[model samples]
Target: GIKISDSHDEPELEFFDRVPTVWDDTKVIHGEVGKYITVARRTGSAWFIGTITNDEERKLNIPLDFLTEGQSYLAHIYYDDPNVPTRTKVGIKNIPVTNKSTLEAVLPASGGQAVWLEAQKKFVHPGILHTQADIKRTHKLIDNKTEPAYGSFLLLKEHKCSQPDYRMEGPFRIISRDGEYRHTKSKMEADFSAVYQNALMWTLTGNKAHARKSLEILTAYADSLTMIPETNDAPLLVGLEGLKIIYALEILKYTYPGIKDEDLVPVNRMFTEIFMPVMENFYAARPYTNGNWGSIVTKTYMAAGIYFNNRAMYNKGMDFYLHGHDNGSILHYISGETGQIQESGRDQSHCMLGIGAMATLCEIAWKQGDDLYSALSNRLMKGYEYVAQYNLGYDVLFSVWEDVTGKYCDWKTISDKARGNYMPVFEIAYNHYVRRQGLQMPYTLQVLEKIRPEGFDRDQPAFGSLLFND
Candidate 1:
């Protein structure tokens, strides 16, 4: 007979779900030839034990000596029960345990016991952009009528009603050289903006209508669109355009229970079959083509990996983010000495785009326990400061290389349009550096204040005030 039950209701299965990886301190505590075996492993201050027996039944003594010295834990034990009159026959009990405690497990013939020992304390939720706790905290803040959070919530409520309507179906294709292609691309961008804004609004407001609308838009495209047509600017389309939708899906899937598992299947398949391959190849093959390409694409890859819960994909994206192939990595674009970005020679628009993308990436990474913001002795902050100084109309002394030769040449001057359209890029950086880290970001703060109540617009970088200000 096989043990059959909902995986969600099983202790061992739940333990595996929570602790995806086991610790290196795993060891075989006791074993007997053809009789029984017992093994224990630790993960994130918790210990899990599994014991198995042959046809012969045996009683085993389990010790809690491996626990942290000063901490206590609640040990959840699951074992086979012959009297339960079910094939699964699993029964569970909770026992308080300490480093000095010992437990006895009674194993039946062809049966085993599983123990999950967890510390009774607050634990941090894991993720890149938003954690479970962060979502709960956002809810609490809104409920408490907090200032910026409530303001952002009210703004999203108004924005959802007044936002432009988007089509359900799309012949979504990329033909960068054609005017029609750009129009379609812009339309798709507008659609994603609606999707993400609505999904996030649903999270804040608990309105089922908003979630349903977001799902309606998502399912329409996922069911109809097979692939995004390739073009000269495939990387940009996949990275910038496709990634925004991915972000919406991430928020929806995690925040709302109304989203069915079946709904996600097709969407995940679309990502794996179409977007994943393109992103993998783009980052590996075209890392040096343009600085913005790597920044945007790496952000997409990292966020997609987190959405799908794929560690390999996440690590691959992180690797490309830190170390690019030729001249496309963050380190490659950011100057270690002056901290000016590589695209600064081109224009401030692309410079802000690149900086904003990298800043968002660092924000997500910081949430996931990686400090790419301060990597390379605060290289990203330096890049932000350099760009902010110039964009704020401050004169900056820097040299630009026109070609591979070390020849210094004057490129396009920073235009009024570039300086005026400051994307909501400073909120995340200012919040992290100034409010959280207690570090000074004078220029970043000035720009952030200038763009107070930084609302959304039809642009590559949207949802800044909604995400970061709160």
Candidate 2:
């Protein structure tokens, strides 16, 4: 028999309804195309979930209150994306999983996953709070009794570019030789920034070996500067320059803390000679007439330039994002001599990029005790409220202006768009800002808290508004 249960004559499960908590089993184990999965979900009265795969390993933070109030319950998980059906889709097997549960989940190569929760009678507290300050903090935070958004962004920990030939791999695959032609060539057009971003996460976590490997590929790209083409149509597949280069330089400085000023001169030379001119032309020519294209690239470069204290380049780059267009102006890529301004994901994403970059710059400035930088930072933070309106769903905010209708919708309706889509990152970031002033309560609660018409928790409200100001 190909597969069977271990029994004397018939198939039977060895551990029926036995909840297994494996917090130690953290790393991903399997990698299969469209069908690999592994997760370590927390099991306690309050649920915690962690999911990852061979392709990408991401962290998740879930609050304990996503469960039934004052009741100990169990979770029945069915974790596989049904849309991606294959012969090896994990079969559904009902098991006794509970809130005080930290379950391990493993996913395959190219496939995705899903996790479900159902109430079962089982109560166990996970000793989450202890000290007086901790208790006070918790009480103050939840006095309004709102739930937190349980989402994660694939943040980079650290990346080092010492050796000159390390390249990273991509997640997608082609079925045949001809099919490969239509797809982006992973090697030829690899996105170095994304690789750096992912590597940064490793570095932040003190994974020195992983950080070195990621940086190796980046150094290789910098060494072969002449070979890498100047202009590439592939948006995701371009070499880092200007502000990105400055970011890389900052990393190098961090890695080699005791290096002399003369040693830094050579690294600075590469930016001034090779990258600076390109930035000047790119900013001056301004090829992208409409859309967020120019702003996104410009802001990335400007952020880096600002870090190096390149006043002229930094100002121009900042201007492109802050004042190039009026608020709510959209970028339109139409058939014309100039790019038209139409609401698009390109602009929305760039808008976030602009605001986020400014925030980081302002923080750096404030730390250095520079009043000018502090002023600029404050201005950017105030301006960000206008763009924060665009965060749409869980991990997938609406990039197109049309999706939001250029005005606030009802909170329930906003919750509808935020349901189960891959937009959790934006929600978390936007909430952080809004929550500071105690205004994140209603909007966040609208999504995490289920609405009931007649005391039935099962009846969730659909199409609710997320526009509660306070």
Candidate 3:
């Protein structure tokens, strides 16, 4: 019989949920008499593979030649992971595979690996981050005011009734020398924050008042902010705050039938007419400021694209996210799987900011049936681990990385400013990799442990414990 219980937590139990009790056929994929053996078994519509090794550890490339050619499978993998804090020391995760796919399994001394490949199926209804199911689950957990979530709910409680910050003051001709137009920008952030907090309250609690207040804030902005001139900071302004407005409106539009298409007339007009020109212009300019700049722009545009059913906009965001020339693209941002991000040598705050910002985009993309989180062999996961390990007071290998602007840290080391003070960034990443994807995120979990019951963030995503803890 399998071991009864362990402290491995989420990944441990999730492995049990999919282990097949019976199979149709079995075949040896590879073997070395007393040293190790790898076997594959087929069930009704799925395939499972198990491999074990003697006391000596080994690295093996297991070719999935047995799978039907030209067909796709979602492989749930369980393997030995010393970092997994459990008696069994097993790790688990999911990855897409085909007959031509090859899995690289790293086995420890007397350790093994397992994989369960099943045919692809339809996914859940795509929403920003909190889908209908996600919202329902959050509400169910809130009924008891669950520990960490309870903590987060209490925090949200303080701001759920935030008065809408519509810039009723005239002379709204905003100007910024170098993103320093704080007065109007602060109001913009506050107004969007009100919408988000109120929408979140309505989601967790069955309070129509909260919903109305959220919509009221959005409608107010629609009425007042007519023209968004391409002030120097217009792109930066929308890139940063548009996500909040889009996320809030998504909740309201899905939950409240009161929102008519015409109600969005002014909002859509403003975004398309003036907002889009500058945002698109920013990417076209290829300023290559930092990973966060392009990343935030990609996120805002993607959110708007999916929300408005604008495929061109969605394509643009996805294009930039995957292969933009800027530092924010997946390839450019991650720096060749060392998990050293594009902004690693810059400073800890900016490094974590870029990480969390990209994590936000990946989360959104994941819900929509794309797997950017696990793309490039879990490159984002590696980045999370690298950042967490450094911030948790450990030394990591560093290499000279230069940006498009030919800039490098002359000190030849990662910046130490605000090192240990972690942002509420890792919780979403931890939940996605460990809980949803069944992969071990040891360092990310550590960060979350240090800062559990994650607080809220005004611009970037926060409230991780409440929003993502499963």
Top TM-score prediction, candidate number: 3
Give the best candidate by lDDT. Answer: 3
TM-scores of the candidates are: 0.68, 0.39, 0.70
**Candidate 1 C-alpha lDDT tens digits along 33-109:** 78888898877777888999999878989877878888867677778865432234566556667889999989888
Per residue, candidate 3 scores C-alpha lDDT tens digits across 6-32 of 332333444455667887988899989
The local distance difference test score of each candidate is: 0.68, 0.34, 0.74
- Model 3, residue 113: what's the lDDT? 87
Which tens-of-lDDT digit does each residue in 426-451 have in candidate 2?
Answer: 33223334543343334334323333
Worst 10-residue stretch by lDDT in candidate 1?
Answer: 401-410
Compared with the true structure, model 2 gives a TM-score of 0.39
Which regions of candidate 2 deviate over 4 angstroms?
Answer: 1-185, 188-195, 227-245, 255-270, 325-341, 345-432, 435-470
Of candidate 3, the 10-residue stretch with the lowest lDDT total is: 162-171
lDDT of 2: 0.34
Instruction: Give candidate 1 misplaced runs (Cα > 4 Å).
Output: 1-128, 140-151, 160-180, 286-288, 402-417, 457-461
Deviation (Å) of 76 in candidate 1:
36
Which scores better on lDDT, 2 or 3? 3
